[model samples]
Target: MRDRIDEEITFRKLEVLLAFMETGNLSKAAEALNVSTVSVHRALHSLEQGVRCALFRHEGRNLKSTEAAQMLADVAQEVLALMSDGIRATRDAAGYSSDRLRIGSLYSLTINTVPGIVVDLKVRRPALQVELALGSNAELLDKLKQGTVDAALMAVPETEPEVDALPLFEDDIFFAAPANSPYAKLEAVDLRDCRDETFVSLGEGFVTYHGFVEAFRVADFTPNVTMKVGDIFSLMNLVSGGVGYTLLPGRVRGVFGDKVQFIPLRPQYLMRQTIGVSFLRARERDPNLLALMAVCRLRTRSVG
Candidate 1:
């Protein structure tokens, strides 16, 4: 029984059978399989012997498939498809390239940094598919740690021993206000002078929010934050519409055009956020992550 099972129709034989059924002739099947006509004939003959059935009948110089051949051809299609799916699943489970890269980033990085990195990564790996997930700094970090995302672009965390980071650039936080506001005209503004200002800010867990809290702490008072938002763009929209003032990274300067103004903070309250790519240290050798790190290094050099 084991010998019979081993000698039963093989995938290669089934491929030849399917090719013959598809093209309807030995010569055509040989052309499709990139083999000689004699090889196609031998494979089909071997398949018939293994199955102990007549899969084809010679009609002079032409051959016609039997009803059995048609049934086997249909099953061959399904078998091949399942095999292909299994191979892809196995590769993905083993951390091999599944031809898709999942990337996480802060909403603000979508304005500039993420776009450039994605474009460069595609240039390096033309067939790689990139999936981008946008969220706050803490949210992206969580996704990276959970392995829901392969890598993340955000403010590098202070302590993550199990993670590897590639610093791309440093961005300073600026005081953001409506274009028509009095603060827009200043060369720089002291955080202390804004003590009486009503403010809108990003909710907790965002790196910018932490910076906001520390900057105000240096000014010796807690900011009167009247509202909190989840994303940077909405916070900017509120600032533009005169809803209230907020802080933003310099990377987002031109995104709002003249609708909003970003003023430098006084030296005592200055804070710079280090933006970079973060991934699991275990995946440091992953080709996709390596490509991302290279792109970031190029970006850093270009910025410098």
Candidate 2:
């Protein structure tokens, strides 16, 4: 019996089996389950095959359950009810209520955007508990896909079928240099003008790194990057200490106080980053994700 049960029975088959018994018609069962009639027929056939028994009697365009099928349906009802109760209890024990949200963001946003978003989310859901993860663009997106984080705030991801993103604001990329540096005086600097300048850059995996590569490619010169730091704050410190210049989004302008200058690149370079919230398309219907998206929409106008 154990071997037969292992081969033929499954929770999904049990659900279809019970639904078929309750409706007593394949089409009605399909409607109740919100599935196609063909799907209900296939599931019933598969269930019979797994149990290695004839569980239904064919009656001219209708499927009628046998005594064995009726007994299985009764057992299925109790099992499904108990399983539902178990799931609810488990969720309660794990503190995984709908009010909890797992959010991810780029480290740069911690300076402004994240703080304000958290405050807004708390206002809307007074009992909400937020778990925040701050990392590079690559890391945040990976976590979203893996389901470790529910939502992310970062540069708009490149085209991917699995990801769903909502664009919040556009941030122009700007050249950052020490306040006393010669490049700091320029209203706008041509990328080619900085060809010989030593530069500090955020390491690979960061969105800014890719933007820098594109900007330099357009300028048709590889920058002499002297340092590759992991975080924007450290990169900003390197530039402010006169080690080298770097590029960053306009949103981070307030971080450096008066130590660094932010000069927009010439329009010809076309360097800009669009900030957005990203999540797996599969998680789109999640209640916590919906709440975070609401906050994102409300805060969109406030972002520069």
Which digits, one per residue and each the tens of the lDDT, describe model 2 over residues 1-304? 5453655578887998888888888888889999999989988888888777899988887788999898778888999999999977865543345667888999899988899989999998889999899899999989888778878999889987999999988888988888877876778889898878899899899999999999999999999998998889999999889999988888889687889888878988767788899988866766667788899898886653
- Model 1, range 23-119, lDDT digits (tens) per residue? 8988989999999999999988888888788988888988999998898789889998899899778768855575889999998999888889999
List per-prediction Cα lDDT, in the order shown: 0.89, 0.86
CA displacement after TM-score superposition, residue 124 of candidate 1 (Å): 0.9
TM-score of 2: 0.75
Model 1 Cα shift for residue 83 (angstroms): 17
lDDT for model 1, on a 0 to 1 scale? Answer: 0.89
For each candidate, give its TM-score against the true structure: 0.70, 0.75
Return the top candidate by TM-score: 2
Q: Which window of ten consecutive residues has the lowest lDDT sum in model 2?
A: 90-99
Residue runs of model 1 more than 4 Å from their true location after superposition: 1-91
Clashing pairs in 2: 8-50
- Error in Å for residue 297 of model 2: 1.2
